[model samples]
Target: MYRPPHFAVDDLPTQQALIRAHPLGLLVVAGPGGLTADPIPFLLDAGEGPFGRLRCHVARANPVWRTIGAGAEVLVVFQAAEGYVTPGWYETKRETGKVVPTWNYALVQVHGRARAIEDTDWIATQIADLTALQEAARPEPWAVDDAPAPFIAAQMRGIVGIEIPIARIEGKWKVSQNRPEADRSGVAEGFAAQGAAGAAMAGLVRDFGRERG
Candidate 1:
């Protein structure tokens, strides 16, 4: 992630929150053939290492498990995105004419070492815990044990669990932090005016301004 100083976001708490809130991530790993990426829904198990660990599962037939071996480094990319930033929002666009169109969003890059959950008991626990966490967020939460024993066992057997001990995290928040206050305010108001995702991004721009104050 190449980030300029004005666009850099080094806040750890913010990064973790971004990753957690955006449960779906792109897990990328290298293998003999080439690089592979999987869009997976993961659980952030927050009690393992200092930065905790990431938990996810892949279909047993998916070759990704074999490539992501013990101690193999992996990159998990989470996108906490909003909307596009229009050039007309910037005051400089009409004044000095020094601004161009850019995107406004947040993202996190977590680097970790992976270990395959091979133990049957541990794998079962992982499946249960993951299902519980995901269901907890729904309107009518579904329990993992709701399924029949034979069906659940069969389903579990078809998947492989993964545990990623996070080694490092890098965050980038590009919500017009590089702009001056006047331009920032102009952008915020512009976003709020559009009544799209831009409206939420405006709040992020405003928050960053408040923090710098």
Candidate 2:
């Protein structure tokens, strides 16, 4: 992730929060066939390592886990939020007509050595944790125990676990931080008025500005 200083998010807590909120990540690996990317929902255990540990499962039928050795290096990419930013949204556009369109977004990248887990017990626990995390906010939360044990066990057999002990972590928050305060404010208000596509990004921009203060 090529990030400029203004857009860099070096805070560990913030990065972890972003990962937890946006759990689905693109897991990429290299193999004899070539580079492969798999989108999988992950569980981030920040207390497990200096940076953290990431856990996810891939379908047993997917050849990725088989070809990419357990010791292989992998990168998990998580996209938090992103939206198109029109130049007209910047106050500078009217002042100098020098501004161009860009994008406002937040993302995190985790790099680590991945290992495959075939142990049924480990997979079972992972399934439970993942299920609980995702269902926590639902009005009617679901749990792995809600299903028949035999059925759950059978389903688990079709997937394999991939664990990454985080060696490196990077976060980038490009939310108009490079622009002047007036311009930044304009962007936030502009995004807010743009409806769903920009509403989330608008909130992020405002929150980021508050942090800077």
Candidate 3:
């Protein structure tokens, strides 16, 4: 998280928004066994604390849970709307030929003390809420209760829940904000032409670029 002044995003709401939009986070931990990382989908409860609380789960068979001691410090990284920006997209490339390629991205890094929970009720509620969040837009949404009770119980038995109360959060939005107005506009136009894959980034570039200008 090397955040330059231009790329730093300190707003709490903005950081939480990215987490909600990109719920899958890279969970990192350093324990007695050493450092380990895993990709896990998370739920953010923004009102829970000064920063917020994060909830997620992993398979019981996964060794990650075992490594996390009570209140162990951990980091979860959430990334949204990112892409490669070619130097060709910068107007400066034509003017002075000084621009180089770079990656444009928006991300949040949350540092927290993690606790592993084995309570069945907590895990059940966590999975249900997570499922609803992801399935709300689907025409035919599925629920944890949709399956047989025994089957659901059996499946739940194989997983463990994780909860983290956020201690610190940092957001970085490198969306052409460091570029000049003309160069930023060039980036917006180039990314806009890329359709859905670039839509989010294009909007970010335009909005942040305008703010800077």
Best by lDDT: 3
RMSD of 3: 1.4
Range of the 10 consecutive residues with the lowest summed lDDT in candidate 1: 204-213
TM-score of every candidate relative to the true structure: 0.91, 0.95, 0.96
Query: What's the residue-level lDDT of 181 in candidate 3?
Result: 86
Which lDDT tens digits does candidate 3 get at residues 1-213?
798888899999999999999999999999777888899999999999999999999999988887885688899999999999999988899999998999999999999989999999999999999999999999999998999999999999999999999999999999988888899999999999999989999999998874442
Say which candidate scores most in TM-score: 3
> For model 2, how does the per-residue alpha-carbon lDDT over 102-164 read when each residue is reduced to its tens digit?
988999999999999999999999999999988999999999999998999899999999999
lDDT of 3: 0.92
For candidate 2, what's the RMSD? 1.7
lDDT tens digits by residue: candidate 1, 86-184: 788888888999888887888888898887776678778888887787788799888878889899888888888888988988888888887887888
Better of 1 and 3 by TM-score: 3
Q: What lDDT score belongs to each candidate, Candidate 1 first?
A: 0.83, 0.90, 0.92
Clashing pairs in 1: none
